[model samples]
Target: MVIIIFHFFLIYSAAAVGLAPPSTYLDGCQPMSCKRGAPSVRFPFQLKGRQNESCGSPGFNLSCNNKNQTVLELPKSVKLLVKRIDYVKQMIQVYAEDGCVQRQLPNLTLSSSPFEFMSDYYSFDSTYKNFSLFKCAGEGWSHYGSYYTIGCLSREPGSYVKYTSSDYPNTDLFHCSRTMDLREVPEGLISDESNNLYFNWSRPECGDCEARHQGCRRNDTKPSGFECFVIPIKHMGTRTKLMISGISIGSFFLALSLSVVLYMHHLHKKEKDAQGKIEQFLEDYKALKPSRYSYADIKRITFDFKEKLGQGGYGTVFKGTLSNDVSVAVKLLNNFKGNGEEFINEVSSMGRIHHVNVTRLVGFCADGYHRALVYEYLPNESLEKFIFGDKGENHFLGWEKLHEIALGIAKGIEYLHQGCEQRILHFDIKPHNILLDQHFNPKISDFGLAKLCSKEQSAVSMTAARGTMGYIAPEVLSRNFGNVSYKSDVYSFGMMLLEMVGGRKNIDVKVEHMSQVYFPEWVYNRLDKGEALGMSIENEEHDKIAKKLTIVGLWCIQWYPVDRPSMKSVVQMLEGEVEHLTVPPNPFASKEEMRAKLPINRELPTISE
Candidate 1:
């Protein structure tokens, strides 16, 4: 019986190893050279529709546009022409088709995409200067000769400020609708076409394999499924040699053995270090307020991971029911980089949080490497489905309900900032993270990117950028904006509020013209011009609510962190009379210019009935 069990284990291991498909399967995806002097396309970026899904993962698919030009689609529905793909550097140079890359700049958010803009690669041209395009509606400032006219605004009488030398336009003086960072600004100075942008990806599947003279193929044996397999020497090159000039095969084997021994020792030390961290976490775990469940309890509660609720970059969420008929959301964490920091973060933050606006943590499982968090089940799901989509019953939530939801969210954020023993800053605050209960009341969920600081700490230090791109504060993006503080969460909240008011994304791609693209900037222009809010108002109350939300949102989204209001102030503004509210200084106003428009004495302008 012992021999049979050993043989069964060996057979299972052998089958697992054999499950990895051959690199030959990827031979179909061999480098393809473009006819237009474009870079050779290779693994990770496969031609969509032409290549099988197995050839590339999500966000790695490429396609040819209507003009037969290769284009790469990014997060937030952004598409750029593929000018060059450098396998050697693992970077891609993209160009905007119309040369006005600035129009697409606001949409180049990568939080949802697998790619990132290359930080190291900037415009190498010394003569290049950053130019901005503002889509404004007002008198044509022909005297400001530097300002190029793009087109006329359809919603109002203003012409789009086609191009400008500054990002912060004199919005007080110029009724600018929207502004976006223009890529390849020098090109705009010369020609009206051909703008270049560079993007890089950190997905290791293809790049790492390529570096080792091997090819990557998708198989089910690994978690990510993509595996690196050895390529034949002949495929590497005819002139390539594997051996050192002075070393014999036997000597190489002996040296390899020694290296392996050293590597094993290093791994052993790493294991010990990991174990120490785990033991420390366990020691600290006893003090936490939340209930800790064993791995078996987690599996049993989740019914062997039967029903998956959803999945994201962090991990997959499963629907679970306790023995007492209470439903819960169980998030099984995966692809954690180190030491279970995310697990600790959620448990630590949510465990202490006890508010109606914030989601409650019912229990947690941190057995060995298996980490999961259980939260109260939210029946209505995320605010995104209701706010953005045309799904059944989602859009029927009246403007009043939307107002309540926004207020609940503001209260939740205010609680996070002040209610806790330590102030928790939720870096990622968007519609998707805002969960709605059965009554449509909002509860802020997902604290994966949350940072806890002492109540006395005015600013928090961040080594890398956190939060979603579209909602991320300008300060968090760069220190030049301002110090990272509780105000960062305020910026994200403002963006979310604007989305709720607009019933669309802030950086919408489907808008009729570039002038109407960024919803917030467009609304600001109308408000500054004393024009109607230009929304689909059902009645006077709906119009008032929409306008109120818009004004409050604009106040929250001030360009500088200091300019923005605190969550406490935001909640007050939402609950207070709309008549008492005032229009904020134009966020896009330039530093050189004085106040462009005088502050309005009356209430915020309402949408025309």
Candidate 2:
């Protein structure tokens, strides 16, 4: 069946290559600019009024303002004036129209756009340094020459705003009070002069063409892709054209035949190796007593895979029913690229856990190449739907229910880390993995990235970092923070707790104000100032519950793993009164120190589960 599909794909490719002729419009798409000295926009960057859509890549559209200045609008409505574009280097120099890019730094996010900060692209580091913003009384602080004053945020009443990159600034010396921390701007890009930000694009890659002084255009064979072509000369001889055509046709067939043979051989070898590993794993764990079903049984239970509960990188989950009339969620492992390691991990960790807060593994199917795991169905679904859906959904849960849910999740994580004989570390602990029952009780699910170690073991060995981004602990990404231990799970839980309090994602780029972009940091600053948490607080009791959760979350997310509390301590803190809870030290304080530890050009191993 696989070979037949491959043959069809090969035939389709051949037809596509034959049908797609070279585009004749390249000569018409000449470079244009808003005015003299303005950056010339060409291929991959189209001038909106002057060029057609086919002339440039998607999301690379540029426009000219009334002042005849080249303008580029990034995601979230950030507009910058284009100063210069280096096509060979694939970099763009842009600055805010107001001449102060620092004013827009908080809301400036490039993740959704095709461009990336030049410093980030070169350094291979996504971490940002925290710049402490201070509002000082009186404007005659020229003695503190190291600090730069933000003219836009400064006031006329003998007060001005100054910022320093130092994590611990001497506030008394400058006679200033810390207002907030700016983390979006990189240390290398921040300057007192004109805020010229350099950004480079990796897509519509034409560096090779630019180096050779050739033309690049969209690949006609694949519209979503790109291709480089040689510059055409006027009036080619017929003999030269015939010779070139013959050579290209001959080479195309030769390469296609070779690729087909090699691909088939590679697929056969991979399937044999994967099957062998599965068989060995099953033999090793056969003594464990979960009912193993055949492929036919899985089909019948899922009613021919009709209803899909969810789909992820690993596989698709279907809603199913057992012979005993019990409902179950069957996850069919369709994209099994690993050597049965994730299958082994899930079964090994979940088969032994029986806590009320943990999801139950009822049965599994390992028939031939088909593999699936059946879990008890939770009618209320995941906690993510309720918390992040809408204002109405959040109101339904209320502050009290959110507090209770937080405690239940903490207890569940505690059980995974300690209740069982072997310490089970759930590498992924986001809100999506936490399922809620009809009674709204939380159950931890998804053990594909779980690790098992003896309770006596202080840390576990890891070949690669696991878990979803934004929730992964510092140590898991780099060992400079600490060892990969149960504390990693604690860090992830802390992030989720903060997310629950804000009723939004922890790293929200769509926030209206720059200061609120990083929700956790913003929450910490608000709490530190002894101000109202800006959340939906109807009364003082709800306020107390929110503060307690926030404090516990802050404590759990401390920069160093040693500073974070254990799951056991986390549960106690959650259960304790808000008055007894104390706010943790700023987690963003040591970002500069930790950023130095990240090695450049270090390739993280691919996690294939």
Candidate 3:
């Protein structure tokens, strides 16, 4: 009778808390297996934009890149590719997306994110590395072979830095740029080849609970936040002890009551906000030319979302046939976040675009937040499904085809940046976003993250970081790299091009041994040393295509936004001879401290609509 009463109380508590039965509500945290070599994701770590936020603790949200790699975005806009997550040890192993650890050190503060240095009740695998960064004028320390040489600081002309082990300078500092000491990092973590780093965080130890097949969560009634509720039958002993210590049934009931009210309120506010945002967007995009379709029309066109095409950060795609016998892809966006900026962006930007390389926006539907976009259906899917997929019989696109695809993507980007009346910067340009037609021609798609600005404007403003982890330019992640501009898109394109050349992700931890996980840096090292491009060369033409793509990609991904060439230059470089094309400076070699000044233009209106 007592057991039955206890079970009834639990059910009542769960209902009062507005939670599904434990089997359902807690199922979100079930270990998730990634397609690639990424580690299984579980408690305290959830894939952002995919898994529910409640599945993970605050500051533990992660994102999966198009390449199926898991990434963690830290404060100060640093993104580290997750190599491993040791649940028992509560440690996470990560490698810098770019091999430059020094560049990420300045922003590696723990205050903004939940992650903390080893000093904060956690232990690290290695000791900290202390290095000195010296800024000198005109490469005075050029003769020093031992020093890590960073090129001229962009802000201060004729100033260069010799990154070294000691704070004491061996030579005179007469012609030096401003020098600073980097944060003490794990020893050997900032070396020329250093790419992997580790961080640990304190979370409730739930291994025993998990072993016993029970769910664990924080004991919110506790003040220190260290206590947990090991759920189901396994934690009965702990519950008995807590009950004896005056953890009243009433307090738990009260918490459940409050949580229910708060959750309902949150849901109400979220729906209200989403509706208002959509309404405001409709008002702003009233001038948009894409004909708006009703929700019934969307259902008719999409045939009730039956034939699925693909999925992405924003939504899912389905195949549809129009009244005119034209095949179309209808994208139905998820409405839970972002204030409808992505929906407005697609309709406003792609509706006005007309180019063979750019995806044609056929129409849209925004009836009561049933947001969907219709586009001309290409027979072939995205370039990612072709190039980055497992090398099966159908996955291979030969070098000539790959080269043609690369050139087509370049032209599409150039058209967007230069040909548009108001230059549209497609912030997210990865293989997944690039669609291919039956003839294997490439078309730029997914303008949801696109930003618009006048042709004369040098840069656009942003409230938060946008774009995928591996492809985001240094500047877009943090202002310290340089001003965000069209060059940011170039950086993304460069990464994609490199992926095409390597026939793999640029940062594949499984293949690249040692600190050579960052493929761009590895390529730079080989190219600088005049090593054979390190690819399986079928013939002279294949070698030339690989070399050309590698060189152009290197040039496009220069660390500073200013150092990267415009899309127009990238196109020319791609078309030029492989021998004529010079390998760009190692993007990860050294940091460009100073940036060139550009004439500031009037601030453009916010792209809220």
lDDT of each: 0.75, 0.81, 0.75
| Per-prediction TM-score | 0.50, 0.50, 0.50
Per-residue lDDT tens digits of candidate 1, residues 75-175? Answer: 66778788777664577888777666555545655556766554335423223455666666655644365566643222246454556556544445356
- Candidate 3 Cα errors over 4 Å, as ranges: 1-289, 391-394, 592-609
lDDT of 3: 0.75
Cα RMSD (angstroms) for every candidate in the order listed: 38.0, 35.2, 36.9
lDDT score for residue 365 of model 3: 93
Q: What lDDT is obtained when candidate 2 is compared to the true structure? A: 0.81
What's the lDDT for residue 467 in model 2?
A: 96
Local error of candidate 3 at residue 26 (angstroms): 99
TM for candidate 3 is 0.50
Candidate 1 structure, TM-score to reference: 0.50
Query: For residues 1-609, what per-residue lDDT tens digits would candidate 3 score against the true structure?
Result: 344445555665555444222233334455564565679776677777767776777788788887788888887677888888877667787776666555776666545666544422255434555566767656344446556564332235566566666654545545654467665554344543445566777665655555665555544566644333344322235555555334346645555666666677878999999999999888757634577789899889988888998886688899998898889999999988689989989988998888899998989999996899999899988888776757454577888899989999999999999998999999999998899999989999999999888888778888889999899998888876666788889999999998888777888887738656888888878879979867778998998898899999998888777778889988888888888887676677533333233223423233331
